[model samples]
Every structure is written in structure tokens, then in C-alpha cells.
Target chain A: MREFFERLGLMAEKAVVTTGQIIIMLFQAVYYLFLPPFKFRNMFKQMEFVGVRSLFVVVLTGSFTGMVLAMQGYNALKRFGAESLVGPTVALSMARELGPVLTGLMVTGRAGSAMATELGTMRVTEQIDALYTMAINPVKYLVTPRIVAGVLMLPVLAIITDFVGVLGGYFVGVKLLGINPGVYIGRTIDFVSVNDIFYGLTKSAVFGLIITLISSFQGYHASGGAEGVGRAATSAVVLSCVLILVSDYFLTSIMF
Target chain B: MVKLSAEAKVGIFVLIGIILLAYMSLRVGGMRFGKEEGYTLTVKLDNAAGLDRDASVKVAGVEVGRIKDIKLQDHKAVVVLRIKPGVRIGRDFTAALKTSGLLGEKYLELIPGSPNAPYLEEGEEITRVRAYADVDKLIADLSEVAVDIKKVTGSMAKVLGGEAGAASLSNIVSNLEEITYNINAVVEQNDERLSTVLANLEVFSDSIKEVAAGLNVLIKENRDDFTAGVTNLKAAMETLNSMAPEIKHTVSSIQRIARRIDEGQGTIGKLINDDTTHEKLNRTLTGINSFIDKTQRFRLYVGYRGEYLFDADDTKSYLSLRIQPKADKYYLIDIVDDPRGNRRTTKTEVTEGGSTRTVETTKTSDEIKFSAQIAKRFGDLALRGGIIESTGGLGADYYMFKDRLKLTLEAFDFHKDRNPRLKAGAFMYLNKYFFITAGYDDFISDVGLESAYVGVGLEFEDDDLKYLFSSVPPISF
Candidate 1:
């Protein structure tokens, strides 16, 4: 029992230290945000990397997500003779919750894992150390642009996701299931509001910030060999996903 | 599989991204582009259920605008509506929150008021607003009415069913029985009066029986006188019976005489049966029938006319016939028995012997005279001008009630030295085929023919006139 308690204590200590390190790293990244060249070249590169490149996967996920939502909403609302509500149901889910959440996850898998792996490889090869010796602020040079790009592009990606998701729902509801087009679009406009989309974009921005901070933090702290880099990349993706889901709940409650 | 960099095509990809974001912001996020800014109006609503930003604003049940924003101010919802240009909203317009479809999503409903009201300017708040009714209150009121109906139905059931209904029905039956029993008691109380009436009736019947017995005894005593009278009647009948043969002979002779009459053998028989007499009678009948036929075409008015001569101081009477063919045309003929006749009279006084002697002279002799007129009717008035009593005259008639009543005026006996005699009379039917007439004749002429007279006359329809008018047989082709 004493050994078990000791091991638990060690685990708790590690959790606290990890949390503090994450907070301090986030502050440092924010602090470096204003101190240097704005890094538009790097920021645009990351934006293309995060937002443009991830579009295919995000769209695929969004379409399937919306079709499933339509099918499920049709089945449920039809019980109350409200099958016409399927469009608004799909729209509200995508604009307010699913669009941001799914885009964040897909992009995290595509860009965030790539960010961790690449940075981890650079760390293992002593490139980041060499940057530090050459009087370069690595966080500003590497992390700020990535964080800015994530924040900038997640909303763009979410907007695309919302559009494709609603299209997919329309396909399933109106074409496949014979719902009236007027009822589908009318109910969507009647139920969905701008605030829903705005708050969803807000959640995507937060998710982007989170995915960047955690992925870059894991990459910055890499110590082991090539195997350790893989672990860091995996942990970054897992942590980013977990944080996204957790923050989505709190954001949804606040916005609602 | 391959690497694409932002150094090439990044601008285009980013541009596309921005464009898509703007599309989503304007289309999916329900925002508007800056180039198409429209007019805006605000509304303060009491209760705005299911209202959200970017909801549609409708006018006359069609979408004309969108909700720009919604906020709570002082516990009331303040909504800004962005309306497209060229769509006018009156100041007295009203806004309400209504479901788009039954039990579906809700939207803001705007009522464009009459054009006479002021136009709604941009950013102006509307005053007329209707909030969603509280469904719970409506249901509560409905339930109250239902409870009242239930109470009424329950009372009806109580009256129609169960022990209370039975008790009331029995009570009504008992009251009826009691009323019948009271009537029986009242009949019993009048027993004495009823018996007295019965006894008086019995005594009167006994007196009548006594009178009938006395009459029977008187009849027995008069039996002998009745038999003697019957015997006398029998003797007279015997005398008649004995003369039957002579009477039979006389009847045979009369039969011969009747046969002779039928054969045109005697003067009286010839008078009845001769073809010459028959021909004469037929000619007379045809002439009379033709006159009757002419009369049948007319509605006849018979009037008694009297005239008083001022100089002669004598009254004359005449019977006049007015024949009306249609309501509008008539002919008048009068037979006058003039006492002073058509004469003009004069009296002169001469003082030859110191005593004045009056000498009367007549300018014309008394004569039987007549008047004739032809009238043409125009609505209620008719114009008549013709010879009247051997002189030219003019007259008028006013008809009433389909000519059942009339007032007539005849100006006749016109003279240069004297005014024309004007006769006015009112004629009315006392009954069908009978009339009474009253008139003053010569009211205007001072020399003669001025008199008032009233008389009733029979308007006779010749008995043969009916056959003459109706005897046209059915024409054969």
C-alpha cells in the first residue's frame, strides 16, 4: 500500500509539473508574439499547410458527419412528426458544434501531428539547439507563426466544413429521403443564427491555439531518440484531440 | 504523396479560402456583404419566443428583410431589422413572433400598415407589437369553459337520471292527482244545486205530459167534426169525379184546339205559328240583338239629368246614356224632357191704363230635346265636345278606380247673350250593374238649365246579350 501510494504521488507530481510547464510555455509563446518580425511568410506557409491542405480530409469528415446527423435526426424527429426539422437539425449541429469540433480534430491529425513529428526530428538532430546558439528565439521563430496559423485557419476550415456539411445533409434529406426543399432550407434559416456560427468559429480558434501549443510544446521538450519523437507526435495528437473535446463542452455551455 | 508550397499557388488557395469564409459568413452565418447595406428598423417586443439573430423579417407574409441583431434591454427584446431598399414600411406597422409552420421554427412577422400612415424611417422603432399569447392561460380559460359545460351537462343528467329525477316526476304526478281530487270535491259541493235543477226539469216535463193528455181529449171530441168536414170534402170530390167525363170531353176539344194551333189553323194559332209572323219576330229580334250587340261592347252609364230654367222657373228632367267602349273612349246620348224646353223667355211690363200689366213672351216653344257627345280619355281626364240639347257643347270627365267612379262636367246650350250651361255631376256604382248619380246642371248659365238632381239607375244588361256575346261557336278548320 505504501508503494502504491508513493507511485500515485509521483504520478500526481508529474501531472502538476506538466500542467505548469504547459501554462508557462503558453505565456512565453504569447509574450514572443509582439517582440519580433510578424513572420507573415512563415504564417502564410502555416496557413496554407493547416487550412488549405487539410481541406480534403476535413470535407470528407464533415460530409459523413452531416449525413449521419441527418439520418439520425430524421429518425428521431419523424417520431414526433417533425421530419421536416432534419435540415435545421443538421445545420445547427454543424454550425454550432460538429463543424468546429470535427475540423479541429481532422486538422489536428493532419497538421498538428506533422508539426510535432517535424519539430521532434529537428530537436533530435540538434537543429533547434543550433538555432538557440545562433541567437534565435525559437519560440517566436517556430511556435508563434504556427499558433497564429492554427488560430487563423481553423475558422476558415470550419466555415468550409459548415458549408459542405450542410450540403451533405441536403443531399441526404432532400434528394435521398424526399424532404421538401423549401421546408429544409426554410427551417434551417429559421433555426440557425449568426451567433451559432460565430461561437463555433470561436471554438475552432481556441482548438487551433490548443493544438499548436501542445504539439509545439511536446516537440520542444523532446529528449529521446527517433522512437521518442514518434511518441511525442502521438501524444501531441491525443492531447490535442482530448483538449478539443473538453473545451468544446465548456464553450457550448457558455455560448448557449 | 507530393509537396505543394505557398511560394506557388498559395495566393490563389488563400483567396479561395477567404472567399469561402465570406460565403459562409454571409450565407450560412446569415451575415450580409457590405455593398448591399439596406435600411434598418428596430422593434421592442414584449415577448419574443424563439427569435434569434439573422431571422427573417417578413412583410405581408413575404420575406422582405432579415433580423440584424437581437438584444435584451430593460427585460424587453430589442430587435434590429435590416430591410432591403425600395420596400416601404409604415410607421403604424406591427411586428410579432410567429411560427413559420405549425409547431415549427419561429420568425418575426411584420405587418405593413396602411399607406396613409407615416413611413418607417431607418433605425426607427415600431410602437405596435404583439406578443405570443401564453398558452397556459388560454388552456386554463378553455378548461374553465369546459368545466362550466360539464356542470351544465351534469345538472341536466341529474334532472334526467337518478333518484332526484324520479322524485320530481312523482311529485308532479301527485300534484296532478291532487288537482283531480279537488275538482271531484268541488263537483260534490254543487250537488244541491244540481238536484234542484234536475227536479225543476222533471216538473216541467210532467206539465208537458198533462198538456199532451188534455190535447188528446180535445182531439177525441173534435173527431166527429173532422169526419163531417172530410165527408163534405168527399162530396165535393164526388162532384168533381162525376164531371170528369164532361171535363175529359172538354180537354179533348182543347187538345184539338192545341193541335189546330200547332197546325196554324186559327188566327191565334197563326199568330203563334205563321212563318210571316215568325219572320217579323226574327227581324225584330235581330235588330234588337244588334243593338244589344253594340251595347255589349260598351260599359253603359245611365244618369238622370235635371235642369231648372231661371227665367221660366221650371225644372226639366232627362235620362242620359253614356257608352264607354274602352277605358279611354265613350259616347254620350241623353233624352231630355224639358219643361221649359229649349225656349228663351222674356216678360215685359206696360203702364197703359195707370195700372202695370205684365206680359210674358216665349222666344221658343217647349220641345223634346236630346244631347250627344263623343269623349276621348287621357288617363284620369276625358275631353268631350259635341251637340248638347240641340246646341254645341264641350265637357270633361275625370275617372277613378278603373272607371267605377267619375266626376263629369258638361257645358251645353251655349248662347252669345247668355253663358253656356255647365253641368257637373259625380257618378258612382252603388253595386255591380247599378249606379247612383248626383249633379248640378247649368250652374254657370243664369237664363236656364241650372238645377241639382240625384237619382239611382239600373244598368240593365239585356238577357239575350249574354247569348249574343257568348254564342260564337268553336270555329272548325
Candidate 2:
């Protein structure tokens, strides 16, 4: 029991230290955003790759998720003669929670893991060392653009997801179920509010920051050759997903 | 020159991604940098489901503004909406968040108040807002109501068929069957009558059209005459108004007479109100029937002897009577006797026999035999029983009276039958009982026909009995 208590104390200490480090990192990011010698071109290029290129996959996943949600909600509500409420059910779920979280997870798997692997490979090949020797700041040159892109791209992806998900719900709810389109849309609007969308975008933005930081941190600390780089890529994805879920709850509690 | 390496490619990709995000943010996120040409308004809501900066704002379903900012102040959400110039709201405008489509992004919607009201100023806070009515809770409540309704209906079905119910179902079913048969018969009998009525209606419609045309012609030809008639009516009304007090006095006298009759104070009132009059009438009718019976018997007895004398000639000496009477006219009666020198003649007569006779002679004529008879007749009359009662109260009482009084009218047994019946009458007091009391009493019995009675009553009051008369106006006339 003493050992267990000691372990708990150590774990608590580690948690505090990690929380402090994250806070410092957040402050650094905000500070860097407004600093001189800003890399606008790099930021723009990263945004295109992350935001524009990932649009189709995000929309596809979002629409299917919405259709599946409607089907499930309809089945449950129909038992109680409340199938008409499916519209608001789908709308509120997507706008408040699923739209942001799902888009973050998808982009993290698609782009976050890829970013870590590319950077890890560069580190193993001594490209990062070469940049250091040339007196260029590696954080600014290698990390800033990707960080900016991830942070900015996520909200756009979330918006697209929200739009496509609604359309998917409409297809299933109206076309398939023969519900009046006007009533479905009216109920959706009536049930959903402005705060739900705002909360989702805010969550997406935070998730973007976490993904970029995890991928870059894992890549920067990579040591072993090919095997080590592969491990970093995998670990980056897992950590990013965990952080996203944990942060989502906290953000929701605070916003709501 | 160094060829672009994998690191550079990745770097460039990241840069591209950043630029694309910025562009999307500006385009799709509805981000605006410069001041827009609009008036800004703020609203505080307890909850904001999915609103954000740059969200579109609509008025009357038209895009009139966009959300500028959303922030929490004092634990409440403050939303700043930038409305377009020339789009006006009122003090009573309601702000609500609406989704564009199912699961779509939410936008701020402003419901404009009355147009005639003063417009809201720039930067004014809109206080009225409608929060989302929780769809899940509403659905739950509706389902609960439906369950309650089902339960009530089920209970009602059980009560209607229980042992102690108002009617035996079997009796009701038989009555229903009889009613169905009667309805079918009536429908069959009225088929030709209905066709005649339809024909008459068509003719009436044509006549109405003709009348309308004739009226139009008359109006065109006698416009002056019509105006003169109207003028004359107006003058007559004026003259009546000038003599109103005298007319009112005359009307009051007539009303007093009516009130006396209605209160059972005079002969007509007693005839209407007293049950003894009905009993006396019934006894009188019975006595009349008995008297008619005695008179008919006297006539029959007087006519009977004439037939005996007519057939006397055919008999032998010693006054033997032979009578052959019509069967339908009289009851059967017979007599036989014999009288002769040494051979006796015997005769037999029947009151109901046909006109045929035979005579025979006997050697021993010393013994004499005689026969006499009498008959009685009866008539058909049906008896019926019923009870009637009336009660009288303005305003809601009038409406109640109209409904209840009509029920009484459906109770009277004009054609009596062998059935027990009940009848009730209701009268409404209108204008403090100075108004008329109308009542109807209908006999409730299974007599295959409905009988109804209607009567009007008036009430009176003196200083000593004013309160009693006012409260309990007698409802019979």
C-alpha cells in the first residue's frame, strides 16, 4: 500500500510537469505566431496540402457517419413514435460533437502520421542535422509551417464535415423515410443552436495544435535508423488520438 | 544547384497546406477583416448550441447580417450580430439560432416584430430570444400522453360492458336490429317521396332564379315606390315610438293575463295545470262508452222479436215460433215448441242461423218445451302510462333551456299504447323571468313511435312573494 501511494505521488508529479510543459508550448506557439520573420509562404503551402487535399476524405467520412447516426437514431426513436425527432438528433450530435472530433481523428490518421514519418526519415537521413549546421532554426523552418497548417486546416475540415453530414442525414431522413423535408429541416434548426458549431470549431483548432505538436515532437526526438522512424510515426498517431479524446471532454465541459 | 530533397518537398507541402487553410478560412469560414456596412446588435443567451463568428444572420428568412463575435460574459454567452444597413428590427424581435439543413451549420435568425412599431437602434441589445425547445423531451411527453389516452379508452370499453352497466347488451342489440329494420322500411317507403322532393327542389331553384329576375325588374321599375315604402315604414316606427308608453301599458295588461293563466290562477290555467281535469276527462270518456253500449243492446233486443213474429205463420197452432237470424248481426238463440190436433208440429230457431226451416208432426203432443239465450259484445281500447315534470332559471340558463326544453318536447304520448313512459320538461328564465318560459315533454317508451308536447308559461310576482317567484318560477301552463 505504501508503494502504491508512492507510485501515485510520482504519477501526479509527472502529470503536473507535463501540464506545465504543454502550457509553455502553447505560449510559445502564440508568441511565434506574431513574431518577426514570419513564414507566410510556407504557412500557405502547408495549409493547401493539409486543408484542401484532405477535404474529400473528410467529407466522405462525415456523410457516412451522419447517415449511420440518423438510421440508428430513427430506429430507437421509432419505437417510441418519435421518428420525427431524428433531424434534430442528427443535427445536434454532428454540430456539437461528432463533426469536429471525427474530422480531427481522420486528419490525424491521414496527415499527422504522414508528417511524423517524413520528418523522422529526414532526421534519420541527417537532413535535420544539415539544417542545424547551416545556422537555420529547425523549429521555424521544419515545424512552424506544419503547425500553422494543422491548426488552420482543422476548422475548415470540420465545417465541410458539418455541411456534408447534414446533407447525408437529409438524404436518408427525407428521401428514404418519406419525412417532409420542410419539417425535418425546421426541427433541425429548432433543436441546434449557434454555440454547438462554435464549440466544435474550437475543439478542432485545439486538436490541430495537439496533432502537429505530437508529430513534430516524435519526429524531432527520433534516434534509431528506419525502425526508430517507423516507431515514431506510429507512436505519434496513437498519442495524438488519445490527446484529442481527453481534450475534447475538457473543452466540452468548459464551453458547455 | 541542389535538387529539392524529400525534406524540402515535405516542407513545401506543409507550406501549401497552410496557405490553403487560410484561403478556406476566408472563403468558407465567412471570415471578414474590414468593417462591414451594417449595424451591430448584441444578444445574451443562456445557451448557444453551434454559433460562431462569421455565421450568417437572417431576418424573415432573408440574409441580412452575420455574427461578428461570440464570447462569454458573466457566465452568459454574448453574441454580436452585424445586421445589414436598411434592415430594421423592432423592440420585440426574437433572436434564435437555426440550422441551414439537417446536421448543417447553425445561423442566427431574427424574427422581426410588428412593422408599425419603432425600429431598433444600432448597438441596441435584443432581449427576447427563444432557446431551443428540447426535441427529445417533447417526444417523451407526447409518448406519455398517447399512453394515457390508450389506457383511458381501454378502461371505458370495460366499463361500458360491465355487469352493472345502464343497459343489457342483448336487449340493446335486439332494439338496434329492430331499429335497423324500421329504418330500412322507412327508406323504402320514402324512396318515391324523396324523388318528388328532389324534383320539387329543382323546380324551387328555378323559381328562385325567376323570382330574383322578377325582383330585379321590380326594383328597377319601382325604385321610387320601394323608397316610399321604406319611408312609410320609418314613419310608422316613429308613430309607434311616440305611442310607446300607451302600447307598453297595453302589453303589460296582456302579459298579466298570460301570467295568471300560466300560474294556474284561472279556469284555463286549472285545465292545463291540474291532473284532476285529466282524470275527470278519462272518467267521462269511460261513462260515454258504457252508455253507448247500453243503447246498442237496447236496439238489438227491440229488433230481435220482429224476426220471431215474421216466422210465426210457418208454425202449427199453439204459437210455435221459428226464427232464422243473420250470423254477423246477432248472437245464436233458439226456441222450439209443438201444438196440433193428434199430430203435433215442432219448430226450432237459431239467432245466428241462415234463412232455412223444416217442420215435423208428432203423435204425442201433450208435452211443451221452451229455450232462451243471451249474448254479450266487447270493444278494443289501449292503455298507456307516463309522468311529466317541468323546471324553469338567463344567459347560460337560456342555452341550457334551449337544449333541455327540446328534450321534453319529445315525450308526450298523443297515441296511447300499453307501455310505461317518462317525460321531463325544462324552462329557461330570461330577462329576470319577465320573458317567456318554453318547455317540451316527450314520452320515453318502446312504443315504435315518438310523442312530444310543447307548452309556454308566464310568471308573476307580488311584493310578499317576489324573492320566491324570482327564484322558483312555476314551469307548467
Best by lDDT: 1
Interface RMSD of 2: 7.9
Residue B157, model 2: lDDT of 85
* Weakest 10 consecutive residues of candidate 1 chain B by summed lDDT: B468-477
Identify the candidate with maximal TM-score: 1
Fnat across every predicted model, in order: 0.35, 0.00
Per model, state how many residue pairs clash.
0, 41
lDDT of 2 by residue, B1-477 (tens): 787644465455446534543442343233243457878999998877688777788987777888888999999999998888887888889998788656667888888888787787988999999977656658988999999999999998887767755477777888999999999999899999999999999999999999999999999999999899999999999999999999999999999989998999979888988999999999999988875554333221211111111122222212212111221222222222322212323455434466665544335544333323222212111111122111110001112442332212222213333343233444444443223332212245443222333333333323333233223435110
Q: Please give the distance, in angstroms, between residue A211's alpha carbon in candidate 2 and its true position after superposition.
A: 1.6
* Number of the predicted model whose DockQ against the real structure is largest: 1
lDDT of 1 by residue, B72-127 (tens): 99999899889988888898888888886667566888877787997888889888
